[model samples]
Target: MTAINFAVIGYGGMGSYHIHNIMPNENERIHVVGTYDISGERQKISSQHKHKIYHSLEEVLTDETIEAVLIATPNDSHKDLAIQALKVGKHVVCEKPVTMNVEELDEVLKVAKETGQTFMVHQNRRWDPDFLITRELYKKQQIGELFQIESRVQGANGIPGDWRHELKHGGGMLLDWGVHLLDQLLFLVDSRIEKVSADLSYILGDEVDNGFITYIIFENGIRAIIEVGTTNYTKLPRWYLKGTQGTAVIQDWDLSGEMIVDSGKKNIQAPKPIQAGVGLTKTMAPPSEEATETVALPKITAEYDTFYKNFYKVVREQAEPVVKNEEVRQVMVLIEEIFKAAKR
Candidate 1:
């Protein structure tokens, strides 16, 4: 099989990750041609890793051997780099928050459509196991319909690196981790969004937000709260979802959590009143011990290829992109509205 030669741009954290970890996978359809970066240190590192390093973007784009380019640069540069790559007849795999805003994304997509080049965004978190389990619970109603979802990612680290702390480079939690959570929610919910409310966090005094909390309401009555925090000394559950007949909690990336589901047992005894701060009441007391049952989080598997492998299929076999441009555009649209809502 002839592999599609891929050249990586940026060679920074994510770019370097692509070159070292992602592109060289068992997918025989993808081949790494080389990498390009402005930083001399990164170039030396790339060369040390036995990769051909291009000094300029032009060198990579002009090279006939490279059929596709992965844009892992700063967010501000994605639009221009993607447009240029597509203009040069190279299919593009862009990192998330595809553009600073949807308008810039539109410009890049316009060129892609006109040039007939394949364009896709990373949005890799859709494959995350936590999210997959949640999706299964939501669809299968193993517990019942998920009526409310509280998703969060908290860390003690203020923010990662310098560029992410600035506003101009699209550095912020909203654009950073926020896009992933938003994309997952949008993908999980089939209903249209009825309303969105958000507030960005800048407690760290950086030009960009250190974190944010967004509440979304869907037409089908799904209420979701998506949040990110970089200052939490203690973190909450990564996912907290409430369904009609059960409640699920995912503590963290380890996927340690459980679902408390209705026991469906008749003649359950009522909870005895417990001591309170000053008052005695049973209204706020926990349900009887027999009222609910604890079960393991559902195990789920996706019948889709990994992002790089899917890119190969899309570019080589004319298969639909696992992460489509339109879906990325929708995520961008939600991001725009989120920023707008924060302003209000």
Candidate 2:
């Protein structure tokens, strides 16, 4: 297979991380030919990593050898870079929140169709282990029929850096972390959202929201709560899912969690009422030890295809993209609705 040459724009946090996380080996069918960053300092960093740095976007785009462009710049720049790359007939792999707004994404899509290039968003969270575990549970029905799912990510550091705090740059937790959580929920449920309600917090007083909570109701009778926060000192469980016959909790990124399911056989003895501050109540009591079975989370099968591999396959017309453009457009539309609901 001929190795596809690629260029990366933006050499900041995510851009540099992509170098290490997604770049294929030298023998693979793809390679990062070079990188472009506005900051000389960031360019220097990329040089230190042994990558050639292009002086400008035109340099990268004009290169006939480059088959693809990875746009890892700020959210606001995603649409422009992707459109330019697509216009030049290069396949594009753009970062999430694909564009600041749905309208911008539509423009990018138009260029992609005109150019006949493969365009896909880097919604990498679809392959995240925790989400994969949750999806596995949902598919396997390990805890019976899933009815409620809550996904959250919180930090006390407040909004990070300048671009995220400025509205013009598309700064906000919703577009940041909220996109991943919502995408995961939609990927797992396979249902059209019946309705959505949201509340975005500006407690930190930035131009953009510091946090948000979005409630989504699905056509399959599943309800999901997706949240992202920057001021949360005491965080909630990373994931809490409840089903008709059991419950699952994942505490953090370490994948620490368990599943407890009803054992079908009833407990031989009734549970004693536990004392509360004001009264004793059987309803609030914990289930007897014998009533439920505790089980380790099932091992999740990993689909280890790199973003480039899928892009190559899509370009070859051999397979459909795992990160489909239509799915990405839906997420962008959902994000717009989330922002609107929060404003209301």
Give the number of the best model, judged by TM-score.
Answer: 1
TM-score of model number 2: 0.97
Where is the poorest 10-residue window by lDDT in model 1? 19-28
Expressed as tens digits, the lDDT of each residue in 1-344 for candidate 1 is 57888888988899888777767456667777788999999889888888888999999989998999999989999999999999999999999889999999999999999999999999989989999999988889977988999999999899999889888999999999999999999999988999999999889899899999999999999999999999999999999999999999999989999999999999988888977889887988888879999999988775434887888888878988989888889999999999999999
Cα error of candidate 2 at position 33, Å: 1.0
- Clash-forming residue pairs, model 2: none
Question: Candidate 1 — number of clashing residue pairs?
Answer: 0
Candidate-wise lDDT, in order: 0.91, 0.88
Q: Which ranges of candidate 1 are over 4 A from the true structure?
A: 301-305
User: After TM-score superposition, what is the CA distance of residue 20 in candidate 1 from its true location, in Å?
Assistant: 2.2
Q: RMSD of each candidate? A: 1.4, 1.4
Q: Which candidate ranks first by lDDT, i.e. highest?
A: 1
